[model samples]
Target chain A: MGILGVILAVTNLVVVVCMHISFRQYGKYKEHMILGVTLSEEQVKDDEIQCLLEKYRKSFRKYIIIGYITGILVIIPFEWYVSIALILYLVWMFGYIFLIQHIYVKYHKKLYAIKKQKGYTYGKIVNEITIDTKLSYAKDKMPVSPGWFLPSMLVFLIPLSNKGVREFILSNLQMSCVFIGVIVLVKASYLLIYYMFAKQRSQVYSGNSDINIACNRVTKRGYSIVFVVASFFDSISFFMLLWDEIAMGSMTMVGVLLFVVMQCIIVMGMVVGLIQIKKKRESILAEDSQERVVDEDEFWATGFYRNPMDNRLLVPDRQSDMNMTLNMAKPSAWIWTAGIGIGTAVLLLWTSVVMLRLDFVPVTYQVADKFEIIAPSYSKTIEFDEIQWVTLLDEFPDIKASKQNGAATDEYALGRFHIRNEGTCYLYIYHGYSPVLELQLNDMKIYCNSREDGVIQECYQQLQEKLSE
Target chain B: MIFHLNMSSETPIYVQLRNQIVLGIGRGDLLPGEALPTVRQLAEDIGVNNMTVNKAYQILKSEGYIEIDRRHGAKVAKHQKDDKEFEVYLKDKMELAAAEAKAHGIELTQFMDYCREAFGVNEEA
Candidate 1:
């Protein structure tokens, strides 16, 4: 498979596997919650509920297997539909999240119907808040102090550690500052989430206050430890980018590898933590034998926690333990959601614009008072006196270079690319076409080329005439 | 004592909170001089406005059911015999309840039995 095909296939596999595992988790009862719905002890043992779950299991398995195969088929159009593959995959991935939710919700509705038919809902929808007063004190300790996060901020020191990265950062201090600032912001955001979890209500899982306190301790520690440790893990991704600044073009993809790895590991760690807390809570309750849980079903009857009566800004997601969703009851939640949505749209729009331009826009040379090369997005002018020499390159060289900035596809390369030995080159070329015109300047090289016959030769003559004058 | 609050009750949040605490004290679930969660702590736990919890604590303090001081924060007050103020409050509540019971054709003995059931259930615990 080509790079696009490889990306599509791998992403498809990961999504399918993850969904398979998480989707199955909804089949079992966790804290008396199933498919975002809460149940009572007696309802859990009912024959109709068991039968409904069995029915859902069969259909869910069949749908998932079919979905995986359909996703795999996305690779078929890789070579022929190269330009659209990324956009296609992105659209598919977006829909995939929703489609899975749709399937889950379908079963949720059926279960709801059965619940109403059998009068299984034990109580009215109410904003019920449960708290162990002793465990809910403000002076309660965190798993680790804020000082633990100081180490995560050490991501700034990474570029200075490596010689090549140090030189790169020194050369462009502004870019380095931006990179460090982003890393700090991400770490700070994680810390904020940890703060929210720390301030969360202490659930009273049993009548014995000590047992309830222990359950809260384990749950808080599980989530808190993961967030703190995960923040430190991010430093590795920053180190990868620093290395990418120096590594050859072939190894440039190493930058993205650590970042993707960090994301996958942190997400998996959080899931593991969730499972650990759930199991431990169950075992502790078993020993205590005085199980108690509040019915906050009204707030969580839907996929979201939306209780205007409750003033919390964030709450645990009912459907998945992997996320802490904004409490829709708060105005700040709407603002945050809108902000994230707009930011994502703007980012996607910028990327799609660049990709489309790189693929479809042809580069053209205009011979005038000064030589100008124009691509759709930008144009560059070179004075006749600036060009020291112009030569027709019979074939493009096999020199390796790292892309500092700009966008690229298989057929074209544009913008600034850093060559290991040659310093820097401004590229405006159809790399596959020849003869290429290499315009040499005092301190840099500008490469220009086209697909049509004699275009480079004609441009070369015009540049020579201007230079001869 | 653990607080179980219902936001959907026709009663206001502060009233519900105040009632729960009073009941906890009556049932000996909240022992005399036991330290209660601070207003902010209770508010955070219930995801309610801080003032709502503060109002509940203030009412408890005024009624002599709890004491709020800087050092001890809000703690259950020492046990006290019912006073004239409490008796008047009780009479008003009982009059309304008794009128409703009379409307439902409940005898005085049956009403006394209901009161015993209400008071005895928690004492059994």
Candidate 2:
């Protein structure tokens, strides 16, 4: 098998292992404690929570085992389609996660019912915990400073370092960096806003806000560290692309591997942070005797937060400290959900369109009143009146340029580019095709080539005739 | 000051924003010449369309509740308590309130008392 195939297999295996660990952790922490009352216990024999946990654990194990086996079997037989198989495995993994979450939510509702029937306490009963609105809404009190996001700007320096680096970045790496940076910034901003505006829940036992503050701090730092690490990784990848020793394909494999590794690290960090927070919360609860229990009737139906009275769209999940759940009762929540769903669909469609264009779309040129060049992802028309001169060259021009809107490959360069001398130009050139046609327009330049030299000569002769007319 | 906009309310968002700003001014929560968040910032904070916020700002500016400038995007305008236009508008609103109260069989004293309470008038004084 090739190195790429091996790398894909290894990454898949790593992902599977990570998934297994995560599922096991979820099973272990299935029982949640609120207000010093552990309503459900997994160790208790024949209890509802334990029974439900066992069922989910068994189902999860069965699916994961089957998925792993199938993945290995497919990869072994159809090694050529390893990439496709890997994607399928990822989809299966996501499906498994969703199935487990559904099961958890279902059983959690049952647990809630049991707690309610047993007259268990949940939130604070006393109204003594007065919120200091000023302190709570203080944006300056955010655990991490905004300056931390500044490091992301360092990515711009990659292009300015050298000419080859600049070319590589503008052609290949700039778009990727922008996409990654935007995602990081969005995530960081959302976290900051959530931390700032989310209603601070009082500790059931005591009015001490220290634990709440500490928990928020931990979560903020944990999330920020992940985003910062991601930005750093993107910068590193850009630098790696500059190295002439590494092939682009191998570099892509390396990037994928790095991404998987980064994900694993983030997961581990979050799990550790959550565990520490849970421990601190428990310790705080043990020290206090006074308990306040509020009716959890709003969350009884689905074990999911659904309160028409609440206006917030994103709320901290009751099931996990590290995750956010949408408040299904609000219209804004629905709007956000729909927006995200549509955005994801659009992204998938755009990716498919790019792929289809690269594989199926042909590069076509026409010569009538104007010279028209059409290529995948980019198309241009050069008017006869704007043409200053038209010449056919036997070799490619030595121009320092940056790609703006089209594809660039070793075999062909078909795109809109910002050439050194010619401000913005359209290029449709095939390396093997001889007699490249260069048109110097009044404002910009146009360079084109074809599979046959005769086609270029005919186009040139046609352009001359049109110009004369 | 934090702007709390009710998305589920029958009132439009721009109207709600305007009413809230007016209420804030009445409550002395927003001071004259105090800068409000830019339209873009407030829109993002409330997760609403920017045009909704812009409309609110526009109404506020036209009514002399706030002023918009090129340098400082938007700010609460200086209080003009004796403006002729405002007096006419208040008289029209009060007439409507009086007619509604009369239709509901509310006495003038009770209606005035309610108005006094809403306006934060000190009865003892």
TM-scores for all predictions: 0.84, 0.55
The residue ranges of model 1 lying beyond 4 angstroms of the native Cα positions read A1-9, A39-51, A70-82, A122-127, A155-164, A247-251, A293-308, A326-350, A383-389, A397-399, A420-424, A441-443, B59-73, B77-125
DockQ of each: 0.52, 0.03
lDDT of 2 by residue, A324-365 (tens): 778888787889889997996687567656745654566777
Off by over 4 Å in 2: A1-23, A30-38, A42-44, A47-51, A62-303, A309-311, A350-358, A385-402, A408-413, A418-425, A429-461, A464-469, B1-125
Candidate 1: lDDT of A108?
A: 81
lDDT of 1 by residue, A1-469 (tens): 4544665676687778778878888888877677656787679778988888888889789878877987887666566545566666767777777888888878887776677677666533545776676777632563557677777777666556778767766654555576678877888798888887777766667778888778777777777777778887777666676566556433454455555666667666766777777788678877886776555656654556788867678777665544678888889999999999899878877877766666777788999998988875557888888889999898777777555565455667787766665777788767678888888988889887888888889999988888888
Work out how many backbone clashes candidate 2 has.
4
Instruction: Report the Cα lDDT for candidate 2.
Output: 0.60
> lDDT score, residue A450, model 1?
87
The fnat scores of all predictions, in order, read: 0.81, 0.00
> Worst 10-residue stretch by lDDT in candidate 1 chain A?
A246-255
RMSD of 2: 12.0
